[model samples]
Target: MLEAARTTPTALWNDSSDLSELKQSIAFGGVGATCNPVIAYSTIKKHLDVWRPRIEAIAAANPTWGESQIGWQAVRDMSVEAAALLKPIFDEHNGRNGRLSVQTDPRFHRDAKALADQAVEFHGLADNIVVKIPATKVGIEAIEDATYRGVSINVTVSFSVPQAVQAGEAIERGLVRREAEGHDVSRMGPVVTLMVGRIDDWLKHVVARDKLFVDPSALEWAGVAAIKRAYEVFQARGLRSRVLSAAFRNVLQWSELIGGDLVVSPPFKWQEIINASGYDVVEKINEPVHEHYLEELNRIPDFRKLYEVDGMTIEEFEDFGPTRKTLRQFLEADADLDALVRDILIPAP
Candidate 1:
């Protein structure tokens, strides 16, 4: 089994660019990569010379396939190449952390039925692929239904506790359904990506209340605390999904959660952080396990009730200004962001 500190290192890469550098980074330590249409469009636009032949070839046989078709095909091909690059680690770790995630276009974010259909199609293109879904109302519903059908999901763009909890229950409900049917539940690993930096970037107004100012230390600490509390709830409920810390804007956030199961970071930043340290530290945190949390979850009348609840979401919290403001509120809360910052970031020298 892979150690917790080694967890998984997934990064975002431009789909059409020379994956040579990206591949080299993966060889160094990156476990997987995440790509979207915007990334695909931008990457291909910038490096069409590198990607034209590949895209044209895919579009050749299926003459009917248009821009959308070609875009999604690129998504699959990039993910497959990334998975192949990490195959050694996958085989070595027995499939624990060497996994790549690819997101469906944001255009499908609210269309549950179409999103589920795309999930199935994407899974067929790559066996190691974990289909990424937005945490919208319909998207969460699609995640629950698709997981029940045996599709692994990565719930993306999550920003609040409520959103994270909903994602956990959706995966658990699927696992429970599968277990009851005597199906193999071993390959299932759902992930909820808590975008911390964006929150701090959004909630800047409250950074300084009447007489206090929020520091990067406080922002980093509060984000981890929120994610930790969510994981605690997941353990309590015996949920099978894992937490993936993502949208990390700095090295500090990644350092704080080095013990987390997986963190999909930006490609360039991850490389910088790993090299600056020049060495891996001894693991310090244990995987959280709580039997009572599981028992309480089992007693629930319907885990799906969370679907109806509305709270902060990536939708309502779009852009940096709002995230910065919300983050400041957490720092100002009674939640002890100071203590968390000290423990997670300021390691003993």
Candidate 2:
């Protein structure tokens, strides 16, 4: 399944200042491009002197577009250009591979309908575009609704098994719904992104940074264990959601999760994975998304609804409070929460 994935690197790391270097990376093996508008906004803003003419041309041609429209237009244009550069691979793979990903603004991460709308709009901009979304409650809902319409989704920001499970189930549900409604399920192309390194970085506060290097085997093993569990959930559910590990900070985590059905790696990590040795297949455990999931799914509180403050918009994300809270409660009743959260939250990125 990993082999079938469109192994694209995040374009955020690409040298926008040097188109040649960016093009070279794309040409080498990147089948897709990933970007968040905020990141794009920042990057393009930094290079606006070099970008103004292009934006001006687009705005000049369109005329009615506003400043925000122009900015997003530039983003779409770059994404489309990057997608076009990868068009051959997209065409060669016959649409199963070589797609580009653009995330909806983080501001609306919890708004299902808004995300669904973005999926439709973004899909119109590029044929190979995969609308990136978080693996949150509403995000999953958005994924389902979008999938029903045949939009590709890359579920991102996942930090735990439950989140990963939600992504897989959402994919299967979307597939089932589409099939029921007489839409083609095969074309929807769903991918689940499991973040690895962010959890490690968070854990650095708890564990000595030097310990990560001192007992490299221990740190590495914990990450692999988390990924192995995630894969186990993927296989158990028998859902078609392609697992795409993200937030990769180094080559080792890439090695651990390379068995994922798909992987959206950062550029630095992409280079590491591309250059790493011993990419091998591993065993998958039998686990299914069960009725028990409905409990958590129902308990999946609306983070956005809870925190409506303009600045604290995304605080309502399940990962921010409910998910972590549940995990905390469980760990308190069980064993070491610190150890488990470190493994689960910071799997290996």
lDDT of 2 by residue, 153-238 (tens): 88766655556666678778877887888776555556776555554443433345323223333333333344456676677668
Q: Which segments of model 2 are wrong by more than 4 Å?
A: 1-22, 58-66, 206-223, 268-349
212 Cα displacement, candidate 1 (Å): 9.1
RMSD per prediction, one decimal?
12.7, 12.5
Q: Ten residues in a row with the worst lDDT in model 2? A: 303-312
User: What TM-score, to 2 decimals, does candidate 1 have?
Assistant: 0.72
**C-alpha lDDT of candidate 1 relative to the true structure:** 0.56
